[model samples]
Target: MAYLYNTGYSSGENYAFLEAKGLCSYIPLHGTYKGGPDGFKYHKADDCYTCPQGKVIPFKKVFFEKKNHTKKKEYRALKPVCVDCPIRSACLGKSAQEKKFTVTFYREGYERNNARVNSPRGSYMKGKGQSTVEPVLGTLTQFLGLRKINTIGIDQANKVMHLSAIAYNLKKYLKFTAKTVKSDTKAVCYVILNIKTLITLQIRLLTSS
Candidate 1:
């Protein structure tokens, strides 16, 4: 996914995640401040980015994006405020020309999306993970009738899990149509669908006739 990289924690985290994946990563620094000794350097440590005034750049602001309805965030440096800084001579002007403070921007949109997903809602969903969300587990224990494990060995246990998982999924496809697919909202249609589903399940289990 294309990202509007900034100078902040989210950018840092993303940089790490991408690095682990062995993907080439780059975060463009926005603003006019010339900073950080590692300017234009690929720093493994927050990419070694700094403000134009030699101060470490911090995550400055966050916003939203319209194209994907995601968050657009930016990271910037405050060293520009260094004109009156006590270390002004050592930070700005040609005398301190050896280096400058840096301003790192996280951009917007993509960063916000990242935060939203990592938020309470996102974390809860992540904590639940695939076992609860993707219907993979739902396909196993409930419909496949494979709640208990009776396999003999490691290989056998693995096989049971695979077969049961498949069977459970097959049952799910047969039981519900795509119209009643997953919805991330709570609405009247959702309520009615759930009620109908429960009633059908109850009748299938209890009726002797």
Candidate 2:
């Protein structure tokens, strides 16, 4: 179809799901401020992340969130890394402990979606959504059976939605076809009548002469 225009669509969720499915190019979203993970560099070979101050923060642990069942990797820098560093004030900003950053659940997907959201093509799609898709969805929800699905379970819900969509498309098709046929018929009748009138005028002129 056309570009997606979901105002309530979560970039994090979208990115994570798509990335997990290996559908899109993933790029992490970095914060431009001090104490942000974007300032750090990840070392795959070393199995750790390096801070802007050159401190090596090794992987501490991996934990799964019970609610979402997603795994999270935590990294922690040495306490001495922030101590006595010239830019420590700018990096830590008076935090008592050492620097630590977590690669949370859906990190890949969140990053990829974030990149798409900030890209030129993404922006164009966003604009198109505001102008087009949103209104269509609004119409469907308001006027069509899409307002609510009475079915339970994913399969039932999917079937209901498909039926609703079919109904809407059929309604639109009928209206469009009816209008087209009416206009075409009117045009043909007007042309035929004009031709017959012209022929009659020609015959009368010849008779009068």
Candidate 3:
């Protein structure tokens, strides 16, 4: 089975693509944390979230995020309740209306990703990456002029990255090809000698007979 190892750059689209390719990915969420905020806790039974100050924010509506094309559930507190609350200043300062928060409607994918990342195997993979891939990337950036891309637009950046990867792989390919050719030559000679010895033995037996 194939696995994709990456940092936080992986998006929902990336995850979907990997799934389509039948490969599992070990990537942290784009953001440090999911859900609304530190103060808000989701209540599944009531289908609402309880704020730090014990105020309930009920579900308002479900909508799709246009950018990622993912369904989201929007929750909000009543304008009157928020307006009169003592902690309104601390919760949502200078707001004339109610407080609002949104969470993904299809959360199974995220939860599954979280579980994979928190597992023992995931931790080992992360540590291995830190010791191997991260250092190589660091070296490339520090010495190979990959620290910053002085280009604009995603297309240009992608082109530059492809060119860089080509150059890097070409160097490795040259080194690998030389060694492989040498080993192959030695193996060919060894097989040819064995064949010659077998032929000579057969000729001797025929002559003796």
lDDT, model 1, position 117: 57
C-alpha RMSD (angstroms) for model 2: 14.8
Instruction: Rank candidates, lDDT, best first.
Output: 3, 2, 1
Report every candidate's CA lDDT.
0.47, 0.62, 0.71
What tens digits encode model 3's per-residue C-alpha lDDT throughout 64-99? 899968778899888876867887887886754788
Model 1 lDDT tens row, 18-108: 6567643333322332323433332345644454444554444555545644444344445444445555574456554333322333323
Rate residue 140 of model 3 by lDDT: 65
Clashing pairs in 3: none
Q: What is the lDDT, from 0 to 100, of the residue 139 in candidate 1?
A: 52
Worst 10 residues of 1 by lDDT: 100-109
Which stretches of model 2 miss by more than 4 angstroms? 1-38, 65-70, 93-95, 112-135, 183-209
lDDT (Cα, 0-100) at 64 in candidate 1: 55
Give one digit per residue, the lDDT tens place, for model 2 in 58-158. 98988876787656778887787778878777777776567777676455455556667678877777777678766767778987737777878876676
RMSD of each: 16.6, 14.8, 12.5
TM-score per prediction, in order, is 0.24, 0.60, 0.56
Off by over 4 Å in 3: 13-23, 66-70, 127-209
